[model samples]
Target: MPHPPVLIAGAGPSGLVLALILLKNGVPVRIIDKERTHRIGSRGAGLHPRTLELYAMLGVLDDILNNAGKIVPTASYDFGELVPKSTMLLLKYHEATPDVPHANTAALNQDRHEEILRAHLAKLSCTVELGAELRSFEQSADSVVARIVKTAEDGTQSEETATFDWLVGTDGAHSVVRKQLGLSFLGETRTETIFALGDIKVEEGLDPNFWHMWNVGPKMILMRPHGVTSTMFNFMLKGRSEHLMNKTLTSDEFAEEFYSLTDRRDVKFGEAAWMSNYRPNIRMVDKMHQGRVFVAGDAAHCHSPAGGQGLNSSVQDSGNLGWKLALVHKGLTPTDLLDTYNEERLRVIAHMLGLTTALLDRNDRGVGEPGKKEFKMHQHGDAMRMLSVNYRGSSIISQAAGAAGAESDPYAEAAGAPVQAAYRAPDAPELVPAGTQGAATRLFEVFSVSAHTVLVFGGDTDARAPVVDALARFPPGIVHAVLLLGQEHAPPSDAPRFGAVFEDRAGHAYRGYGADADALTVVVVRPDGVVGVVASNAEAVEQYFRRILIAV
Candidate 1:
């Protein structure tokens, strides 16, 4: 196969998603994995709403929702039958609030999730070059030179060097990229060995959609329903299991241990698919980008999958980085924008580490001490686990105060314009009624789509004159122009106000910019619908368009 300009070091979720995003934009990408076949292990098994939103953007949400397991909204919090409480609070607090239309999460095994990603990857005709390992890579100012070895089925190997504009490492925890780059992974490794995990089919009369947790003093047992086929059983032991770590255990030993610990011999196992004893360790790479090469997913950070965030976070990391890389390669943006990757992700990682560790500490009992203590308590950290991520403080978003009220619309009754000067909300309103009239409603419609919108405020029907004349005079593709009135807050019923003139309802273009409604100010939102620039004055709007919009 011919070499592509961009080379991705791993074909797991992150690498594949990154490849797909780039490929969609006509960027050439080559994805390679060391494994001879795709992973079949039911590794990570949950997808948050934010992830689903990303999948939606990738145009695969429905496919994923159809293929993955649907997580039940209900959860049970109990430790050794002592204290029992509902887990609704955790779900409510952590999940995305209803203010944004998209909410909730889906749960599925990692292997199945990868299968979905692989299916999408295939459409681009980018095949996974299996049995190929990245041995080393060198990065320079303009490009990356890397070497890989292709291992034949019978064990013979050959090496070759490839040059690419950029190299991304989505490799797992034992990342060769980190070693080659000499980047330090700073964090403590918490060593506790008595843990074992395997996937088993539940009894014929059982249900597997809800997440089930059993806390027996120092030991914590978790059962998560996969698809119609099976459930994953995880046992967290307080002490070290040297023998189990050294050699595999029989299915009878697993059954015996389960009955002895929980006294429920009814729990059963099918043919063991995969079994392993592992120690939980937490760590994060000091940096994500090094010149022409960048690391993501488990390569950039590794933490205990206690909150089921490993795969989710990794996919999100790619979500954050993919678009930026595409824009940079297309010369639509500066490469400096890539710096925001480490800044935004590291901050999120620190917080997730704290929450996950806190949750684990609640269930932790000293090593070698089993059944001595009860469960600490479980609470939902879904919002932090799922949404509310912001790049607000990043260099990408200019730190300017937002404006408020009807006077906020700059195009309102412009000079020589026969438009009414009706007052509207000075700032963007927090929550507008579904049918609320005013600039805020219009701004909401504009922010829904994934583009920078040029809102001509207070434009009466004929007021389209000045803006239309100016827009036609400006270069094409610089900005999307939409005329709005101060009084018409609700979107047009027959035709959507944003996206295209006759388009259906979607997101607000540029986050309801160019109006000073209590809910809106002149705002330029990123394609992801997060605010990038906030304008309070009409001059600021003009200047923003002059500087940023004109270039695009």
Candidate 2:
């Protein structure tokens, strides 16, 4: 059977990752962006710990970490003088333990993040088609027909109609796909607050280690440094910003406003690289998908960038949908699996918007005021680090015995809760692969992005073949079975024939997953690095996947 390409609208982080995941899974994709050129600006610069873990799975973490900046402390000012560290609007950092490899947040421009994703896509022979806009789309019972407009270098435009198996709209807030689908995007627009933001060159006086901020009730100035030599910054100007948003504020005029706020003569502002205004139009659609057409990222939800959940949630949306779509494309899974993406992300995003909106409200209520003293009330804290985000209540997750998944607490992950089905699988280092002279690897490295990983913990050799056989009933490569043996258990000499066998000599995997070493437990992990099922035996593992994957 021939598979038609999956048409993706928008080339932002969401679209790029979704396209990358699909392409990597041998699913053809056509990713298009309406923009004529690559967008510039440090929009949505905060990258949470969980997003870094996604990047690690995507094989782009090294480049992202190397090129990205650290989350610098906000050198807040009360009237004029610099405030203490305790009072700073800073992002709190945490140490990386064995279970949590990426505990700290990363700072990188949204454009650069997209560029890294594009590079990864290129490795798979997939490139984003810029200036190719999906103007409108219509879906039938099986395929979606799209009208795409392509703009040339000379600015001439040509329209073409194409058909696809699936259409994903990552086209941002004003999505044509969503509009065409007529999905109800209901929410309130914060007309009271507006911010004039710019990416410009700052020649002197601003410290790179500290993000400079000046506090004035209803009026605030925030400048976070970026780019090479730390001379460039993403600056925000607030306070009756209606004039700024309405009037044509030039580079020089914007610079003058910066000087007026900072009252600093030493600092020199260069020409503006990019400028835009934001008022935080918080909104979300009732349904993320309608038939063959689906919406992810900004198209599905919009909110303030206070807690930095917007972009992270958008990327996570792509990951959660991509693999399932790939399975459906490969005819190895029922289309019903696609329903989980909507159900899982909708609640998560709703909770995320609530948190970010509350943060914005707190900032509105004088978190920036001089002598204001509430601990991290204005800062990104341990809460909402996005590490603990889970799909605990999703239909696909199969957990019994009254586990943490039954709690339905969207904030459970932030509380450092115990292991649960549909939770982000914890990472464990020092798992020595059976053979290779005891060379060790992390559990994260073993998980695949294109297949469901079944971890068989502390199982005897006699029970291993049945587990492998049950999983082999599915399409090859759709499922990966790995055996986790404790120190007391000796791996058989023919372990290579069985599958991946990792010896947990230090018992990190067992402790991390909260599984008994003496018990033969099976943990089925989804392609997005989430534990989908924790079963007591191989029969239950196969049964769990049967609810998701169509057996061959």
Candidate 3:
């Protein structure tokens, strides 16, 4: 029987990332979007450090970084007087360390970010099917048959049916998959407050280096520059209570409000490229999947855009699901592995919803200070970066005999502790191979989303023998092993029997992994860049894989 394709609904960031990941793993996929063209708005523009690391694994970080903007200072104004401390909340972007290379956030409009992902997908010989809407789907014990409607610009519509082994919904809040699954999007809509958002071209004198904000009593207006171009800006206007009634505004009317809020005669506004009157809704389904069908991104959860977690969390949902789906499709693991997707993400999404809701509430009550804004763009603490999010309690993670207890908070780091199972694998620099002269390699470069990476640390050949023997039993391409030798040990001229051998000249990889140089240690990393097990012996390494991977 031919392999059934994985059907993905919606071509937004979540769907595109999922497609790219599955395609990279050589999994057949079919992604469909209802929209006729790509999106153009600056929705969810903040790219946190954790999301950037995932993008690095997906091989699209360079394109995103090159096209994106760095976080800028915030300038606040009250009435006509510039605030004594113009900067909104004294917060500074954290500098990058050896372990955390992407410690700061970057800004790229959602539309452009999706375009980058779409371009990368094209390189894999896959293209998103546009104007194809998922009307409905029916799933059995093993496969899903979906009905899709294709509408043309000339007012013609055609219906077709396709069968796939699995279905994933990455469509926005109004997801047909979730609706058809009868999942309750249980939450409240903040009808008491409403915001107007638009992408508009600003005339000269509006400095693009700073995020400008104006607060006059109950009304607040914010202008944020699009990084690549100084002329374009994302404009947001907030109102509360009776003043927050939903209504559309013309370009001239929006500009009039902008001028009135800023009280700046020198600045002028051009046409509004994209505009929307939105009331924040905080809603999410109880689960992400039912049977062979799954929901992700806004389809699974949605909340106010206060902390800029919507797109980042959505992309992460895809990242968390992509590898497990690929492994199950390849028969490397049982279908039970897929169940963890919902269990792992739902908890994080719940916490995220609460975080964003609290931020929104704070924004509603004006900052106590006259000229200061409490919740400035990029003012969020370390948690907003999402690097600390983990799946320690995941069913698939097999902790070694003496592994440390799971971190209390999913987004909290366990300082001064060994790398715990299910925690993100931190990146380490300056790794020199046996005979590479002075060249070095980084840990992230050795990790692949398509296979499990096993790092064996030992000082000499004898200490590394057991891991080498155990790894040889595994099939090629399914597992990649690297024998990391301490600086004092010299490798043989020939490569190891299985996998590459590198020398930890600077011991950064050793220390970063919290491994003792004298002890023989084995670290098993999952496809999602999470450390699955930290084994003391090679037997523990073999046992851990036995729990997750199918027999060769």
- Evaluated against the true structure, the overall lDDT of model 2 is 0.81
Per-residue C-alpha lDDT of model 1 across residues 456-531, encoded as one tens digit per residue: 4433333334344444544444346543423335544422333333111232322333333343233444444344
The residue-level lDDT of candidate 2 at 393 comes to 67
TM-score, candidate 2, is: 0.94
Q: What 10-residue stretch in candidate 3 is worst by lDDT?
A: 400-409
**Residue runs of model 3 more than 4 Å from their true location after superposition:** 1-4, 82-85, 88-91, 240-244, 370-378, 400-407, 492-495
User: Which has the better TM-score: candidate 1, or candidate 2?
Assistant: 2
Per-candidate local distance difference test? 0.60, 0.81, 0.81
Better by lDDT, candidate 3 or 2? 3
By TM-score, rank the candidates, best first.
2, 3, 1
Per-residue lDDT tens digits for candidate 2, residues 1-552, read 443479999998899989988887889898999988989888888888888888777778899998887877677665444443333547766889888988988889988888888888888888888899998877888888899999998999999998888999999999998999999999999887888887988877777777888767767888888844678899877873344566646888887776667666667778888887788889999999888889999999999888888899999999899999999888888889888888888888888888889988888876634345643576666756888787876777886555454347665552333566777888888888765466788878888788888888765666666776687677778877888877656677547654588888788888888777666788888889888887777787777888887763
Candidate 2 segments whose C-alpha is farther than 4 A from its true place:
1-4, 80-89, 240-245, 368-375, 401-407, 414-417
> What's the C-alpha lDDT at position 404 in model 3?
43
Residue 1 error for model 3, in Å?
Answer: 13
Q: Which residues of candidate 1, in runs, are more than 4 Å off?
A: 73-99, 203-206, 228-248, 365-377, 402-499, 502-522, 536-552
Candidates ranked by lDDT, best first?
A: 3, 2, 1
**How many angstroms is residue 339 displaced in model 3 relative to the true structure, after the best TM-score fit?**
0.8
